[model samples]
Target chain A: QQQVKQSPQSLIVQKGGISIINCAYENTAFDYFPWYQQFPGKGPALLIAIRPDVSEKKEGRFTISFNKSAKQFSLHIMDSQPGDSATYFCAARGAFGNEKLTFGTGTRLTIIP
Target chain B: DAGITQSPRHKVTETGTPVTLRCHQTENHRYMYWYRQDPGHGLRLIHYSYGVKDTDKGEVSDGYSVSRSKTEDFLLTLESATSSQTSVYFCAISRTSGGQETQYFGPGTRLLVL
Candidate 1:
């Protein structure tokens, strides 16, 4: 079973527009929610992450809005640029020393200029 | 950027053959993980190690094995290559088991089984 589910397998947004991706989780034990960005032929890099205690966290133009009550979270990129085109993955990790991460299928984001 | 490097970045082998991929890190992290990435599957963990000579299986560990002899090296071995095992493998390192610590990933090693 996929503990974390992501929506919109692929997305396209115009430059300077906002890009959003959503993810939902079934396991309440998860406390850490992180998003990773992967470029072609490279490894996934940490983008932004939020803990259950915080409802939102922002890093530069990337923001993560998390709703613990709803068991859902979303990533918002302000003023999306062509350089933002890449694959994004949402992951959840349990608090009980479970180093393993449960990842969403993935979302291929494209910013059209 | 995390000082992680993967060896044999690309490998092509035949079925029934054995293959091994290596991951080296200079960050001296405590946790190391091996994950595979496919088209439909985002990234599935095959195995992980928390310390030297300690290892555990992950979500997908059927045909794979791993070893960590030192803090800087983690190796993933395929007992016998299979067509279904063809995928891109990645290695990740983290300073701690859980919390706000983020895992840093290596470039990746692409393997093909014929």
Candidate 2:
């Protein structure tokens, strides 16, 4: 069974436009939500993360809006650039576990000029 | 890659053969993990090691095994390769300190089974 579900397996957006990717997890025990960005032939890298304590967190043009009550979180990229075009994955983790992470199926985001 | 390196960035082998992938880390992080990434399935943890000779299975531990004899090296072996095992494998290291946790991944190793 997939614990974390992501939508829009693929996405395309105009340069400088806003890009949003959404994900929802079933396990309420999840306390940490993180987004990872992966380039072709590379491993996923940590982009940004948010704890359940915060409703939103922003870093540069990237933002994560989290709704703990809804068990959902979304990533918003303002002024999406071609460099930001890559596979994005959302993950959740429980604090009590062995620090294992449950990742989403991934969303491929493309920013066209 | 946060000072992590995975050997054999790419490999091609036939089914029924044994295969091994190696992950080496420069930092002596106690936590090391092996995960496989497949389309429509995302990344799934296969196994992880908390210290030398101390390891545990993950959700997808079937058909795979791990060994960590030193702080810097973790090895994942497939007793007999299968086509279903054709996927990109990643090794990650984690650090838990000061009430915070950070995980970093290696470039990845692509394996193919015929």
Candidate 3:
């Protein structure tokens, strides 16, 4: 069973526009929600993360809006740039101390200049 | 880049053969993980180790085995290779286990089985 689901297998956004990627989870036990960014031929790195206790978390141009009651979360990149073009993944971990994280299918985002 | 490296970055093997991928970390983290990435499937956990000589299975551990004899080295072995196992494998490490800790990933090892 897929615990997490992501939308828009591929996305194209104009430069300086907002790029949005959304994810939903089925398990209510999940506590930490994180987004990872991956460049070609490289491993994924942490982009941003939010916990169920918070509604949103922002770091610079990247923001994660989390809706704990709805069991959904999204990533919004303001003023998107070509350099931001890459694959984004959303993941959820059940409770604290969980070893495995359930990951979404993934979204390939491209920024057109 | 977290002090992580995966050896044999790329390999090609035939079915019924044995293949081993190694992940080495310099961070001395207590938690280490092995994951495989494929198209459509973002990343699936294969196995993970919490300490030396201690390991556990993940969702996709049916065809894979792992060993961790030291704090810095983790080994993943495929007893018998298969075409369905062809994918990019990654190793991740975290200082501790919790909801807040961030996982650092290695570049990856691409394996192709024919």
Candidate 4:
């Protein structure tokens, strides 16, 4: 079973426009939610992360809005740019410190200039 | 970039043949993981190692095996390669600090099975 599910397999937005990607999880044991960005031929890199304790966390132009009650989270890019175009993945880590991460299907974001 | 490197960045092998991918890290993190990325499936963990000679399976551990003989090296081996095993593999390392753990990934290794 897919513990985490992501929507909009692909997305396109104009430069400077807002870009949003959403994800949902089924496991309540998940405590840490993190977003990763990946370019062609590269591994996914950590973008932004949020804990269930916070409703939202913002870093630069990247923001993570988490709704623990709904078991959902989303990533928002305030000023989408061509360089920001890439694949984004949402992941959930269990409460156990040694547990492995559970990742979402992934979303391919494209920012057209 | 995390001081992590995957060997044979690209490889093409035939079905039933054995294949091995190596992950080397310089950070000395206690936790290491192996994951495969597929379209629409995102990244799925195959196996992980918590310390030398201590390993465990993940969500997708079938047809694969892993070993960690040292703190800096983790190895994933395919006893018999299959077309379905063709995917990009990534290695990640993490250390728990202050009740928080963050995973850092390697570039990746692309493998093909014919």
Candidate 5:
């Protein structure tokens, strides 16, 4: 019954290295994919998002590569930094006013200096 | 971040007691929501309101109720608190524009039930 599945519950990467987190969803009806970043004691914030129309979207050093056919998407942090360390969650929403979001379990990202 | 504020940022209550969490916004947006965050589970929507007096349940609406009498306020009530209800709650707002607009979240309210 879990709609979205995320991998590597915890990850560690060098400051200048790349960090990747992956998520897969079973519901094919989901049309929108968004990633959220949450810090300790704070609410989750929107980091990046993608639609089924595009294969990739990049903003600054963050990139979301989406594969609609596979129902999979991955977040890539280019030149990861300590500030990028936090919990990341992948969410999906169906079309129309079905505005409800189904979120993944979550992944804890850590950047080691 | 969208001028959203949640009152009683932290609370600890006894089981069988009633609790209410308030979300106030200055954005005048059309959509508001209540969600709970727990370890590993990320966040799940409990209820949402699209307009004054127009509301609907979300994925996890059991054991909770919500109301919106005005555009600026949304209230979430736990008729009877339970230990399993311990988690951080968040309020968010979004505009029904081109698409499902991005949501802006509040600082969050932490609640504990004993």
Candidate 6:
């Protein structure tokens, strides 16, 4: 079973626009939700993350809106830039010390200048 | 940039051959993981280690075995490699703290089995 599901296998956004990617989870046991950005031929890096306790988190132009009850969360990139174009993934972990991470299929985001 | 490194960045092998992939970390993180990434399917965990010699199988453990004799290194071995195992393998590490499940991934190893 896929514990987490992500929508829009690919996305296109105009520069300076807001690009949004959504993800949903089926496991209520998951408490840590994180987003990762991966470029071609490179490893994924942590973009942002949120916990069940927070409704939203913002760091500069990146934001994570988390809805615990709905078991859904999203990543919003404000003022999107071509540099932000890459494959984004959402992941969930049960809790502390959970060695396994349930990852969404992935979303390839493209920013057109 | 989690101080994680994977060796044999690219390899081509034949079916029924034995292959091993190695992951080494410099951060001394307590947790290490191995996953395979396919075209349509997302990354699937094959095995993980929490400490030296402490390992467990993940969702896709078939045809794969892992060993962590030292905290800094984790090895994934394919007893008999198959074409079905052709994919990119990634290694990740995370710290053990309060909801601190942020994982740092290493550059993947691309394997092609004929």
The numbered model that scores best in lDDT is: 2
lDDT of 1 at B76: 99
lDDT of 3 by residue, B1-114 (tens): 789999989999999999999999998988999999999989999999989999999999998999999999999999999999999999999744343777878999999999
The DockQ score of candidate 3 comes to: 0.74
TM-score-best of 5 and 6: 6
Point out the higher-scoring one by TM-score: 1 or 4.
4
Clashes of each: 0, 0, 0, 0, 0, 0
Query: A1-113 in candidate 5: lDDT tens per residue?
Result: 78999988999999999999999999999988889999988888889888889999999999999998899999999999999999999989887554778889899999999
Which whole-number lDDT from 0 to 100 does residue B57 have in model 1? Answer: 92
Candidate 1 - CAPRI tier?
medium
| Per-model lDDT | 0.93, 0.94, 0.92, 0.93, 0.91, 0.91
**Which lDDT value does model 2 have at A59?**
94
TM-score of 3: 0.96
- TM-score of the first chain in candidate 4 relative to the native first chain: 0.97
Clashing pairs in 5: none
Chain A TM-score relative to the true structure, per candidate: 0.97, 0.97, 0.97, 0.97, 0.97, 0.97
- TM-score result, candidate 4: 0.97
| Candidate 1: tens digits of C-alpha lDDT, residues A1-113 | 88999988999999999999999999999988989999999999988888899999999999999999999999999999999999999999987444688999999999999
Report the C-alpha displacement of residue A19, candidate 3, in angstroms. 0.6
Query: What tens-digit string does per-residue lDDT give for candidate 4 at B26-82?
Result: 988889999999998999999999999999999899999999999999999999999
Residue A96 in model 4: shift from native, Å? 3.0
Cα lDDT of model 5 by residue, B27-91, tens digit: 89889999999988788899999999999998889999999999999999999999989999999
Q: Each model's DockQ?
A: 0.70, 0.69, 0.74, 0.82, 0.68, 0.73
Select the stronger candidate by DockQ from 1 and 6: 6
lDDT of 6 by residue, B1-114 (tens): 878999999999999999999999998988899999986677899999989999999999999999999999999999999999999999999864344757889999999999
Superposed model 3: Cα runs more than 4 Å off:
B96-99
